[model samples]
Target: MVRIVPFAVEQWMDEYETWAKYNIAETCSASISIDDLRSLSDDPSRDPLSTSTKLTYGAIRGSQTLRSHIARLYAPPTGDDSSTTVSAENVLITPGAIQANFLLLYTLIQPGDHVVCHYPTYQQLYSVPESLGADVSLWKTSGEDGWKLDLEELKAMVRPSTKMIIVNNPQNPTGAFISQEVLAGIIDIARQSSIYVLCDEVYRPLFHSLDKTEWPPSLLSLGYDRSIVTGSMSKVFSLAGIRLGWIASLHRSIIEDCAAARDYTTISVSQVDDRIATFALDPLHAGKLLDRNLQLAKRNLGILKGFIDAHRDTCDWVVPRAGTTAFIRFSRDGRPVDDVALCQMLQDSKGVMLVPGRRCFGEEFKGYVRIGYVAETEVLETGLRELGEFLKAEYASVPLI
Candidate 1:
């Protein structure tokens, strides 16, 4: 008999494409075009005259140049470096960050292995491991405390069977960052237990401002040979269409295992895609793109914050310090609203879509919603106005519990 998957796949199937106003995808707002990418790949001196000819399966472990560029992101400064330096040998490119995550889970987790993860965070981090028959436990983060992970609670949940701890910094829905202190505490716990740490660093360097706050140092940078850092071009470079991502690890053994597992799934990424990704990694180009995105996110976040403040009685948010989305709690007279019903009503009435928090966390976060504000300025402003009007009308009609 075939064993069925243990995770909730049905919940995401229909909802994935339903929310975009332009089929609004709050998951990733970055846009990339074929023409734009081709411009980056032009090399007059090279013998290849056409882009289509370069479409063959490129490198099994990704192009050396591409891997070198990715490594630079985590490399230590040239002289008297305090941080660890990463090499191309330590990196393995994958289809996207999501695929890299799956590869890690498949490689590290076995049927009886136990994994600890922070909740009200990315669903895939826990779900994938659970599906593989790993015993998964949640360490909850409180919204009232700015969604900060409770180190004490984490300490309490550790078991001898625990094999790994998963973290998403500048967290998805809440946008709560894991501070250096919290990261150090976690590292200490992991080191004591010898548990591997899998950190999803896809949102690194997307901070609101370089001066606003110091982001957590990479677990790899901490010199923990067991730690794995996964990242992608989707969020930072605004090139999700290229579908380029990678996993970096100081541990040679884990890197080998992930590569072996990857052989069966993808073998290698597309050649043209890899070439364009390399071009996009040019320091000057990347710096300009990141700066533009940061400015846009800052402006849009302000618009969202002002809107939320105006409707404080109906909604409240902790205000994300980073990332593309924010989570908001909805309630009336201290009684929480049904998020599924609210989401459906808002979508049907105002053509605005918000991901229900039930999908992000478990049942406890039902009254919350994740909203994306990284769209064009006019779109962000208009979407919020529509949402506010819809909430007002709904509140006026429904009886307060």
Candidate 2:
């Protein structure tokens, strides 16, 4: 039996998310209905569903339309207007980015393989590899420095046996973005050692805080053949209902290997989901959907910023430059508070859901809580207001660590 570490963040969400009244812990950018999706498109008459078409396991690798759209995301700034270097052949659709990550890891990682993974990221990124019997080293980053991974440290961590280096761009929990310079440096290091670089880009293109010029290109576009990226419609597109994601890479062998492993796990994603993803990612509609989410993220982040600012004495954070989540530390009289207890109390008494960082991310992240602030404006507002009240009424009761 493979002994895998319990997925703390997922377990926490499964336990608390369904019942919470103010679900501010949600990481998606306010999920939208099919009706909401149609409203954004130029033509509401074109339905996402094809009722007459036969749905016999649809396309095994995913629909060509969906795959094409996924490929377009990796196009370079100065590339040909008509086509991207990454073709539909380079993309493989999966149930979600989670599944994509799993498939890739299962295909590439083996016993005794060495992996260097970014810290303060989704547990699955590192934990899954560890479960697969790989020797994993955490390339730790500090919140004090805005969750930036030091390239020199990453260089030092790379060994001749290092199989892969993994990262979460616009990382979860902290919502800190890895800049273009850093990405290039990472690629440079990987190239020298022939190490595969896997970047989980699930929260991409939702850079609410940074200007367009500061935006980093996808790992696929960084001129590295071994670079691989996984992304989904769930986060920036506001289409979690479809459960559609894809793995895109410049490396043909990587895609082929993942596809082989995926046969046992998933024959094909739902036909209905494929169609919906295609429609949502259509050039006519993709921009509009992203625009709505970007606006929502910015607006909600401001509101969250206000909440953090108002409680400066008790709260501290490196303001997120992108993505939906923010990692905030709560301190009492200059000491860390018990974040697990704090999250539980907030959920039980105040009905506001929050993810405890120490419990979910790692033990080193004491007193931290991840707030997914890009929820519906009203929900975020209410949750933050109640949280403020909770602090005033019950914070003293929460033990100092």
Candidate 3:
């Protein structure tokens, strides 16, 4: 077995305490509460006094109620069956979306398989597959192009041995989304190549502009039997503490394969966590939480954009249409700056920590940094001000290369 080193995402967690003053620790959503989790539990009449004390390995394949709720989140409305119609048998609730992605990679990819993923996405998408001994190739998202995927390049990258295509819509850091047309095109390519599409859709439904008539259709809703979706309450619903996520696939074989693989890995999600997740998924509670998050994201994004406008000469962004984060590029006289050095300088001097883009990509994206604007609006605004001050001081002292 190839030994995988620690994840870069985990490495950044250490800097959080040092930079707490700037409040850029906006990577994950705010923690959830009992109020957010009560909907998933059993009826008071059925289980009376809640026996969470009896925690001897709960359901191995998640509770039917929780799994059923997760399934409804993924299934689209059909002729005879509404979007809500999904079987609990088709769901395998895992520890989190991270584990869900890991299980999918373990189940579908072999050591020598080839997998394609978008660059500067949630690092786990590529890292997990690489750790599994698959040859990983990146489909780079251009900053100039609003970080959209180029299907033409994607077509050129696909090979006969390609086993899976990983995607993160409402993408991390960049917040770029795959349009329905682009998704359709990618699906066609995957179908021709006989590859499965794995979508990390944790950030779904966080659209900045709710007035848009059409939302990007989920890959699963496109009717691709080979497509699998992994989602969680971590981001969209701001229930990261629940640690509840699941995988949904139209193909029974894939679902069974993941279930078998899961047995060796997580075995099952915690019963308490699963119950809380189910409660959060309740339409009333889930909708309210998502609405609140969207409002926060939009307000924070505006604050970030205002800062960018103030520092147009030092930094700029593609400006995400949706999602919680944005990728910002810094340069002097059109020459790229050292993002890692800049990130470290900001951390040490101003106590602002931003994720260096190089950490998001294997080798590319050296001059960019991924910053989240999902915190309180005032917090994001303050961080941006500190970032601006740091950049101004840094560039003022050094000559453009």
Candidate 4:
């Protein structure tokens, strides 16, 4: 009897992704096979899967090797080591980042608690908290100004009953990144209020478009013990098939509470998944895998940029600073086009599937569409080529909202 709103983005994908010829709607960094993972390793002879290892319920929390790797992600860059290092005990592995997000929300939120969440993000960030009977306030950001969140506005939204503040970095649909200064500001506010800050950082470290100096560290690394970050091998590592992710926090109590709540939902993730995730995150392979993906993201993003530039008259966007998605708006004669109709017609006619912004994200996003642009180079090129043809031939007919 939990009357939760349907997860529109997920439902849309489930409905139309099956027969998509050019799956440009996918958000992962072009999924890779186990063999492909091995190829990236300096020692290609080592197999990712342990052939003789018997499958059991594995570690209740997670394998030590996997947890260690996940912990290492929060450590400061090589030359900039910090006193606040995360240990294996500080991490709890889950089936995916989705489960990690859900488990944390379920453990923390209660009826009548006020929650502030970043808007225009993956719906689960706000929707899950709302379903838990919490009063959720959306901290809105706009595409016109590059999806920037104003810190002063966030301060105004906080209430005495506020228990948590949630955010998504390298946000979904828009792909705008939060800067270091803004992140510090958010932490300062949360710390003063004694509120928990949960950051869904599933798309992190894939900052293909940012310069080295512009790269921001993980939220957990900001020296805030109340901070919780969830990440996975799905996005940056391109290993969605493994379905491995983790919840990390410097606060032992937070990790302990999540682990307790996790007992009913998941005793342990698949043993095979644990092994694969460990191998994928191994230092020998992780760097190479990231390098391959970073190159692909940079290349495909250029192709997407070309398409945007060529069709500037009809389409406009806040070019993504990181992550795989881009939010673009389409208009005809100075009026917003019907995004649902445009998406359906494009997918049905040309097989270039896309998520309609108005239907999936919110009604206010009238003519917007979310494009996962970090697909393989050839797929993006072909899809955009076909999309260009669709725009030229079919755009005029797309009714304005």
lDDT of each: 0.78, 0.92, 0.77, 0.92
Ranking by TM-score: 4, 2, 1, 3
Residue 300: error of model 2 in Å? 0.8
lDDT of 3 by residue, 1-401 (tens): 66676677667766554546775756665545674345334454433125655876778888887787777676664563533334777777888888889888888988899999987787788888898899999888788777878899989999999999998887887878888899889999999978899988888868775455567867777877898888887888777776888888878789899888787778678877876676677654566677778888777777777888988888888888777777887787787677777777777888887877776454567678788778766667778788777776765543322
Q: How many clashing pairs in candidate 2?
A: 0
Query: What is residue 140's positional error in candidate 2, in angstroms?
Result: 0.7
lDDT of 1 by residue, 1-401 (tens): 22335333236436654554632335454465655544543453432124456466778999898898888888654563777788898999999998999899989998899999988777789888888888999988888788888889889988999999999876787877788788889989999989999999887767773464375667777887789989998886777878989999999888899999999999799887787777777664566666767888889888988998899898888888887878888888787787767776777777777777775467788688787677667877877888878877775543322
Clashes of each: 3, 0, 2, 0
Worst window of 10 by summed lDDT in candidate 3: 40-49
Task: State which candidate has the highest TM-score.
Answer: 4
- Pairwise TM-score winner, candidates 2 and 3: 2
- Give me the runs in candidate 1 sitting further than 4 Å from their true place: 1-19, 22-25, 34-52, 77-80, 209-213, 397-401
Clashing pairs in 1: 20-23, 20-24, 21-24
What are the per-residue Cα lDDT tens digits for candidate 2 across 1-401? 77899999999999999999999998999999988877876675798878899979989999898999988878777743532399999999999998999889989999899999999899999999999999999999998887989999998998988999999998998999999899999999999989999999999978889999888878777778989999999999988878889898888888998999899989999999999999988989898888889999999988988989899989999999999999999999999999999999999998999999999999999999999999999999999999999999999999978
After superposition, candidate 3 runs with Cα above 4 Å error: 15-19, 35-53, 77-85, 392-401
Q: TM-score each candidate.
A: 0.91, 0.98, 0.90, 0.98
The digit string of per-residue lDDT tens for model 4 on 206-250 reads 888999799988998888989999999899999888888899999
Question: Residue 28, candidate 2: how far off, in angstroms?
Answer: 0.3
Please report, as a residue range, the 10-residue window in candidate 2 with the lowest summed lDDT: 75-84
lDDT of 1 at 331: 88
